[model samples]
Target: MLRTVSYHPVVRALAAHGLHTTVDVSRTYPQRRFTDERDRQYAIAAVRALFGDPAGREENGRFHCLHYESRPESR
Candidate 1:
């Protein structure tokens, strides 16, 4: 079980201040260890809420990754 604070909105606020922001989220355990699909979805949603859409996603045998970057021009 993972819990995230509502500070996700701060990412945009930092970008508004002309600061570049990057976030990387990776699973701590193997995919098979996460037996609950809802947990996977929740993790994805939490990261998305904090950083907006992911710039990239990758999954290998070991773990999954979600990458996010906020560029001033993109915003």
Candidate 2:
């Protein structure tokens, strides 16, 4: 079963930092939401390079955002 993965704040934050979030980022990693700045930056770069643009929207309330998964990215 798919899990919930809301990475709006992180993706938004990365975009704000001039990092382009991409879609291929979906399940690109073992986990979503990175606490480490370096990891986040790397992930953003990687996803941006592979996916190009990050698409997301708020669902199940303004708090939950669908970053890179239909249901969730697990964890």
Clashes of each: 0, 0
User: What is the Cα-based TM-score of model 2?
Assistant: 0.29
Residue lDDT tens for model 1, 37-63: 665566556646655432333112122
Q: Candidates' TM-scores?
A: 0.30, 0.29
Give the 10-residue window scoring lowest on summed lDDT in candidate 2.
57-66
Q: After superposition, how far is residue 64 of candidate 1 from its true place, in Å?
A: 16
For model 2, residues 1-75, the per-residue Cα lDDT tens digits are: 112333557668766656665554343223345556665555455445544333331111111222342322334
The lDDT, on a scale of 0 to 1, for candidate 2 is 0.40
Name the lDDT of candidate 1: 0.47
Error of 1 at 56 (Å): 23
Top TM-score hit: 1
The models' CA-based lDDT, in order, is 0.47, 0.40
